[model samples]
Target: MSILMHVCTLVIKILVLPLQVAELLGLYQLYKRVFPVFIYNISFSYNSKMNDKKRELFRELLRFSPRAGPLRLLEVGCGSGANFQHYPSGCRITCTDPNPHFKEYLQKNMDKSDHLVYEKFVVAPGEDLRAVEDNSVDVVVCTLVLCSVSNAPKVIQEAKRVLRPGGAFFFLEHVVDEPSTWTYFFQHVFQPFMYYLGDGCEITRATWKHIEAAGFSDLKLLHFQAPLVFLIRPHISGYAVK
Candidate 1:
């Protein structure tokens, strides 16, 4: 890499490292209080590698999401607007995230026109969603968000409630893995730390079951593993028709 690039990378790492360290230590409230003040956008220094990884996973999701085109899309925790670029034409997007922190990033990276807007970046917890029209959305895309929500079941219900008939709910998430013994062990060990560091993400909750229980049909398991690591990629990416 060139000197300027190297220096920039070093600077970003320098800026983010403290928060990363704090997050891993289970000091989430502390991280939350300080993170917005320090680390505003996580993907500031986008490169081909990051873009390629994003495309691969995102493409994988689109391939699995049933009838993606011309759908009214709702992304619950859209961050940095990375997924906005890949939406098929005719798909109108409305993103609701709990962070107005990335408005500039979204404008620069994803907003191509007036049609797409981040209606409300930050919102009060689940009950606040009562305003979203019921059965109006054709698709609800949520990835890596359920892990952190205060109430996963409520969100799943909301996603289901807002989905149009024949609509699909797409998920690409890092969830608690199975093989009874390991799953149990992971629940016991990781729950406390993960809850704090990972945005109150629950490592043990059965999100699949929750989604299924919400009366959505056609559950498909795209992938899963016992331990979820970036390198290991123990992610579950799939969709269920609403």
Candidate 2:
């Protein structure tokens, strides 16, 4: 089994050699351009597989009174707007992502969801949400994002900063498995490769810790195993009230 794993990892590395070369040559713009296309092509299949559980979670977390008019929602790392369908009707969504290439895909999804009110998409990382005003949004959301950020704590703090009093910050992220587990072994083994291939996603990050220490007034987090690859099976999902 050990030998097989090593062989598999080698084959994966070889397959991504071109990307490594591109990065070495400072062709980061190439990566930025390609990654969104790659994600756009695969997002439909990925979302279809994860829809049942994610839909339920979004429904629960996004519940708000219509009496408040449209809810103001800001989603960081809003890749291709995968969560747009799950949002409640009449949400004024402000989408942010570092990759500008995703805007085209995001607009396509937005067009499909006529119920949602589209606010402009901003090009920004989760760590720095300077374009968004403090305490301006009713909800902040990030799904499958924390693992790739440069600083998870900074992202969580930014989420808290943009949310109004009593607003919720919703997150659904994959986390590292416990030590001594086979999955943990695999996660570490493939992490370096995944970091490059996933554009900085680190499978072994304990993202829940950052969220816990973000000083939210109330937090409700739960852990579960998602039906994903072995390296990313362990997942966390919930909301923190600011």
Candidate 3:
């Protein structure tokens, strides 16, 4: 049994080396070209467990706000425009992502959705969204984003700054696992590789804590586990009013 265990561990270690090499070569962007499709497939299964919770939360918030004109949505790190299908009809959307490779995917997704008015795709990080005007957006949507940003707080601040009064900030993010657990320990242990392979994602970010500290009114949140059994399973989803 001991010899078999050792062999299994060795095989796992060998498998990780190629991934590490890819990271060192900065091929993550290229990797992401196809990775987004894989993620969407997994997400279709995984997110169904949550009953389309993020989309539900977003729609519920939108109902409360006046829809005098086409509701303006600013999505930070809107990778491949996955959330575009979830939005209501006749809405204006500005999708931002740092990866230029995503432009083709974003356009493809946008073409599928007749309801969304494609504003533009900006190549910018979440921490700085100067291209978006202050007090202009009706809602700011961020999902699976905060973990990978260079600065989480600045992203929150930028989100706040862009939202019009009574505008909503909806986020769904995988947070750090509880302390003293094996999962938490391993998250930290493999954090460097996680950052490299995940495009700067920190598996152990206490992002929900930062959201609470951002000073939003009516800050409602839901803490839940994803269907997957991984260090990034502990997640928070909800909205805060600006």
Each model's RMSD to truth, in Å?
A: 10.1, 2.9, 4.4
Those runs of model 1 whose alpha carbons end farther than 4 Å from true positions after fitting are 1-30, 33-70, 102-104, 112-127, 179-188, 225-232
Best by TM-score: 2
> Whose lDDT is greatest here?
2
- What stretches of model 3 exceed 4 Å from their correct place? 1-43
Higher-ranked by lDDT: 1 or 2? 2
Residue-wise C-alpha lDDT for candidate 2, range 1-242, written one tens digit per residue:
56765776677778778877877899856777788888888878878877887887788655543355788899999999989989988889999999889999999999999999999999999999999999899899999899999989999999999998888999999999987688976886787688887888999899999989999999989999987777888999889999
Candidate lDDT values, in order:
0.61, 0.87, 0.80
Predicted candidate 3 versus true structure: per-residue lDDT over 41-110, tens digit per residue:
5556655665567567767656534557878889999887777777888888999988777787778889
Task: Tell me each candidate's TM-score.
Answer: 0.66, 0.90, 0.83
Candidate 2 — which pairs collide? none
| Weakest 10 consecutive residues of candidate 1 by summed lDDT | 225-234
- TM-score for model 3? 0.83
